[model samples]
Target: MAALSPLKLRVEGMDCGACALKIENAMKRLPGVSDINVSYGQESVALTFDEDRTSALTIKEKIRALGFTPISERKDLVAPRSAPVLSAREPWWRGKKGRLVIFAAAMFGAAFAAAQIEPQWSQWAYSAAAVISIVPFARRAFAGAISGTPFSIETLMSIAAFGAVLIGAAEEAAVVILLFAVGELLETIAAGRARAGIEALIDLVPRVAFRERDGVVERISVDDLALGDIVIVRPGDRVPSDGKILEGFSELDEAPVTGESVPIAKQAGDKVFAGSINTNGELRVEISHVAADNTIARIIHLVEEAQGSKAPMARLIDRFSAWYTPAAMAAAALVIVVPPLVFDADWMTWVYRGLATLLISCPCALVISTPAAIASGLAAGARKGLLIRGGAALEMLGKVRTVAFDKTGTLTLGRPQVTDIVPIVGNEGDVLARAAAVERNTSHPLGIAIVEAATARALDIPASFGGAIAVPGKAVTTRLKDGFASVGSPRYAAEQTAPDESVSRKIVALEEEGKTVVVLLSGKRVEGLLALRDEPREDAAVGIARLNAAGISTVMLTGDNRRTADATAGKLGLVARAELLPEAKLLEIADMKKLGPIAMIGDGINDAPALAAASVGVAMGGGADVALETADAALLRNRVTGVADLIELSQATLGNIWQNIGLALGLKAVFLGTTLFGVTTLWMAILADTGATVLVTANALRLLRLGLSVRHSTERNQ
Candidate 1:
């Protein structure tokens, strides 16, 4: 036995969710296949199977035999590929809209001619139109039946059309096929529009790069560029790969990657990403990452994985549909057999009625309603810089009534600066220099701030320190010349040796102003007090206010002292909980869950545990990789307002889904009632089913418009 690997294939000719279900069932029966997921919204199928037992070519051949085209081959299921290809040999009449129009026109022309001709000629005209218009549907239905799925929508439509023809309603049969064709065309267009955002993102990266070597530039594919290779990006061209600018300068528009909506000035030493356009000036960049490893590629891969994971509702619908079709077919059989056998009704009329019931009960619209709306919502959120992990996150975000934030990097800028320093015994420079030496290699923002303050004063920092150790969220200790020294929070220093009255007063004053106070100690004796402050983001208040207006409570959680937390919280008009360690923050999140569903927003490694514990976790895009990977959603622009926007988007998306479901089921109920009675004909039932599909699709598209409006408003405010 061999390990199972995943594969994805872009499928063509899928009009409704029923088609997706049919493909899924057919593929699931194959040996060694597992974890099958098919998304009608994305027109792609994903599955994991043992390569030794099956291969990609075999899977594609199976799909072809099932009456659909598998357009792209997947060597391994990883990143999403480009759109499906249409062979040049494919006839123009095979195009969706063109086929729909041609068949519809033929059906109408034949029906009109039949009504004006002699009775003997009328039969030939109607019969010819029926044969021509129904050929495509008949072929698909035949394929599905032979492939062991006798209850597919195509099969139901074919049965209905053939029944109409037998009952002397050949023109009605032609009209039903024409209308169904038009409906499928509309669905294809809607799905394409929903996928436009992802396609646009994929198109942003250029296929080729201008590599500079030996004082000359040569054009080569992006895949050929290796690390440390120099690439030249002229003005108005997209940066070919992710790298740092080695020479020249430019204003790069990073809106495509970061969703920042601004052009940032970049010079030497500044990092640039692939897919960003150079607005002005030429730039020579040293490639840091190859094409497949770039930021754009990672984003695309994450998005595709997110889209493939099904929501709870979507999975439930799949289960329901699995049985709905077979049961409906059984009911159709009962209508055909019982009414004629039990009531002595005319067999032809009852058979015609049964066929209409079969067509109306295909569950095409019901099966598609949820996924179409969810795909549109996810795409809309991605366009606005919010990367919602999957449908489950989107659905959960809508129910969040309380949002908790990690103060240091989420509510405030992660960068801290030294505000004041008070030396208790040693000279200011001597105290600062010793602290910087001990803190030089630390990743804590406060430690970095101390080192930066000493450097700004031109004090010499030691090249190395011996016996350095960090106590999480407390202090960093190292061996000094005469004795051990430490730089850390006041509580940690107090635990070693209580600070003097004067030093304690200084700490109180600094903390009162929302500054974080740390003590520099030498051998259990206080040397100086260092005050650092990480300012709140400019959009923090606006973001909190927006969440408040939407009736969600906000809380700031931090490891800083109580006074500093209160000061910051008062300024932002939110509640505060301070002096919390990583484990403490996790407990706080657990406690908050009693109030309602809680969402934690943070951008540091310490926030990872709590982020994973919360109902939903949102990470700032620029945060640590651990936090981002642990979070359920990410804000690419690193804006706090994106949190509020995500909430609104989720609410709107869930609402849109319900509306689609209602429209699909409500119309289905009406047509089913009319179908059972003598009031509905085969053509009318087909028209109703088609009309419902179009309405549901159109409703889902409204999310795209809503997304645009939200984006415009965000930009205007910015």
Candidate 2:
């Protein structure tokens, strides 16, 4: 069997969906090219080929011959994570599209002015303008015909422009050409906007960094910073790389990377992500990730790759455009020949009508409608910390009727916290310090949570004298300088000294409120009992309420005990299924598919299978690599309500695509009727098509506004 290989290439000149369709149709004719997806929004083409019959080089050459430039061909779909080359140094107005528009507009103006001065000189002047303006498209039309697409949009355009000129309708021909130049310029500008939005993300990282070595500070490129190198970030500076703070106390604003607007207080030993702004205090930081692999870099790479996959509607339009031009050309031939030969119409009049029909059937506006909106939607979502994998995923997100979340990390803040500290024999500080000291060296979740709580309170924790002895699922005991200290479950403490009624009631009440209770002991005497639980996030209830308002049902799946799951779910107003293994969660996701499309949000390695099983797998920002890779979308910020934001954005984008389609098809239908009835002229036909192109492009640009307007918090209010 021949191995099928996939290749992706960056297509620089492919600005419109019609161009992508032409390239796709031409490449598919090759022997071993089984499939191809050329995305105009992302400006890239992904194709699968049989290596036994064809090579990647042959494919590249074929694309080059189709009148487009293909660069940076790669076997891997993920492009380099460095800054994207979105624009050239020269200004856009001085580029090829600009120069062509300037020349054509000048000629048109001269022709219009000549008509008033000398009516006889007007036709020649208009003919010259039309001839010069159409030369480039005519050449490309020839190339397209030689390749596989004989009736491409460019070919239709050339025939319409040249036919009008030969028939002595020179004034309309010149107008048609000028309109085309303007339309092409509009498409070029839109292309820049699509790419520029992504470039904005890359601009967040400052180019220079201040590295301090042995107390001497030197400025260097951010890329030069490596692992373990200490860098100094002053107030008002953006953190250059992901690292831990060695010496600093200040409030850091992490709005850029995590989308949290409120600044978080930070001290030494706290971790910081690249692109987050430092609001106050000078900090000494040790670099973690190399420049190319920072969190921001990973996000940009994901967005670029996501743009390569087109939505179902966009794909449908691409295929429709391939055959639509040829069909329209055939219809045009029938209109011209059947009228004069069968109905005895004038030959000259029929010829002019046929030329106008060609312009109406170009399909340029129809083809570009879906992709332009999709590209804008993806860019907008990325800016707000919602990262959908591709257009298909974006479309799917809108249709999801049920959202299943993993409880531990998805609903609640995955870490346990000390909620209540009761003192039976001494003060709260004395009980907490001795408990933290006994657990400082233990590697358990509860032990770590206790130690963190003590550290957070700035309490002194003495080091353990020696190794601690742990009883499985019961208690851990260590010898202090005075005697033995123990921290464990209530039953473990009772073996030493049974709890009285007062202590028993406190433990029971805390347990009823969905907390884990542990007893603190000094020797055989009970000192106090602490209550802990994984607290629900502040936005969990509000996010679920939004989903409920949108008619989406919410549920939680977790491996934690039933009591703990119910406690968290009750507060969030969601249904709960507890103590599920990985396989069980996968089975539950399959069962939920009967309701409708499901979106599974998870954050651990065990959630990979379940994430993949759902209609769309969504990962939390702090998810494991396996879970992140398996998921189709991600909330890059730790906002529970980003799920609602993703759904809303998807619906808005889809609605935009439908509107663009209606305008394109509606204009063609109306103009086709008017031209056949002799109610419109060649210039009017071209003008209407140009008008549709402008409307579709302008409508797609609105998605960028929706993206920019995306809320930082999931609660809808900001």
Candidate 3:
């Protein structure tokens, strides 16, 4: 709710820079924008805009339209897509350009040995090593500095290294170069972790699907699968493409899209999406769309765009980092130039103090803070089967208070089944037989439930029943020798005469119990009730309770009537329930935000818009591409309990991040005070700086072992 400033832009080339500049400028230029800053040197731009005036994508396109491709690299920075790929390795020197680290290390070691052995040989050996290291691995630094981009992290480090060498401090020069190499390596690794989940999302969709041709299923790629093309999908296969089932029945494991664990039953005419796995039964489907427009491809596009979409807070970091590095440089200059000139401090001593300031002022904490928390939080969520796309999403998840949920795939397991059957006049067996016969020709959730229920009961379906009418969003009607029969909800069977009031009351009672009631009407009388319901997830209630305990209010939002939604909410002990359509749900979320942040959970086509509009949109892996792409977080395990774990993990990871920052800053402050007071020597400063790096690095490694002992114990108890 805080007002922010638009970032100001001062960049060039930028056909790339100009593009990035325009984005930053637009952000600043917008109404309610407080300030803006644009820098091509760091390959990012920052903006402070009113959350009300412009959307996240509007800013992204402004950058993209400038013809500078925008990369999804917001630790909260908006950078060109061509900006260096963020590091994907661990939080060590491992992922930095390996050659650079090796070269810098070799030079540092040679210079250090020379300094220890002979003072006269020290200058030459150290300067030579500095030249060698700079020529090989620091060209970018020197070139970037000379190219009018004077404030790059690389340029700063290179300048400091040359300054040390110029003073005949071979040991100091060598160490500075080495330290810079390590910092670059660490930065690269952090960047890599930010990009890992998004890259995996891109890889999920294949380039092709086997297109069927004239009775022969040939392996033609997705591009060739035109509308109306027949595609064959066998058990254990991904749906060839997004299409409607023309023949065959199967159970599909659509975990990748819906994030549900159970397989959904599919029959002829059922719509199936690409990337869904057919767990059982073979399916012959007709492609409804080309590969480019398939559900899987759409998911890829959404994720890519979402990755490019910066979180509201990411821009703040970019702007802060831009000013942060230069501010530190200015502070270091004060340490050197001010003390020696005004305070009459010795040149070597004050200069050493300046070097000490430089050593710790790499903005290492700033660089590592966001990504370290993100990687750790993401890893923890993934361990519990949550696939968060990147840091922005991960951070947003922790802020959500109200949680809007999709009905079918998110809460009800997406596969409804008949749980009870009652007959008022005839035998129950006869009522079920007639119902199943009518429903056998349809593939709606209710129809499938009836058929499956009848099959479970071993009821024999009548073969001669004919004239079945499959009505969308209504009861299926068919003719029997006895009379006209209908099976559907009370509301859906409106064409039939009203049912007995007593029977209707009972049906209402059944509905209140969270059972989907199917009224069996014979002419004008209600003959029976077929109660169906989506099976509750095994751990849903437990998960909801856990979330409540963690201070996150749980909510169930559905398109179903208030009775059904309220019943489910009561059963699960959810804090809130909103029986709403897609757009209504979005409005509900908007209202919820008046109290606090909201996280929306969903995995259906109808859920996409709400997911996009929420503070943190969470996609169930078993959901559609629209939902997944629009969501800020993904529950890979498709379990409600995992969401609780994700929140807990994010909170813990953020705690760790603050601790690391405090440690880094505290040590630097103490070291700076000691160096200025003459209580610390140059060697001490060097040790302190390197030691702080090592400590932070060690602390970051804790993320690698995701099985934190405290978390493990908590899970065991749970």
Q: Choose 2 or 3, whichever is better by lDDT.
A: 2
Off by over 4 Å in 3: 1-119, 135-138, 146-148, 166-168, 182-310, 379-384, 406-408, 419-444, 451-499, 519-529, 559-567, 575-587, 621-630, 679-701, 707-718
Which stretch of 10 consecutive residues in model 3 shows the poorest summed lDDT?
Answer: 10-19
Q: Find the candidate with the highest TM-score and give its number.
A: 1
lDDT of 1 by residue, 430-506 (tens): 88898998898887778888898998999987554476898877889998667788888899988999777878888
lDDT of 2 by residue, 624-673 (tens): 23323558988866667888888999999999999999999999999999
- Give residue 546's lDDT in candidate 2 (0 to 100): 86
lDDT of 3 by residue, 1-718 (tens): 7565344232212211212323454455545655455533234455566667765566655554333335443532232221123333243433234557887888878777877898788778878987788664355544344433345545555666766766656566676666655654544454444445445544444555666676666776666678898888888888866789999999998756544445889999888877788888888999886766676555444444343344334455456766777887889889889977997879977776786676556555544444444444554454334556656776667776766666666776878977777888789898898888777877566787788888998999875367687554347788776777778666755457667777778877888888777778776677788887887676678878878887777778765656777788788888445435456777888888899878888773456678778877777735444434445677655677767766766666666666766776788789888877867654465456555555554465465456334543454476
Pick by lDDT: 1 or 3, better one: 1
**Looking at candidate 1, what is the lDDT of residue 716?**
60
User: How does each model score on lDDT?
Assistant: 0.81, 0.82, 0.63
Candidate 2 similarity to native, TM-score: 0.82
Candidate 1 clash pair list: none
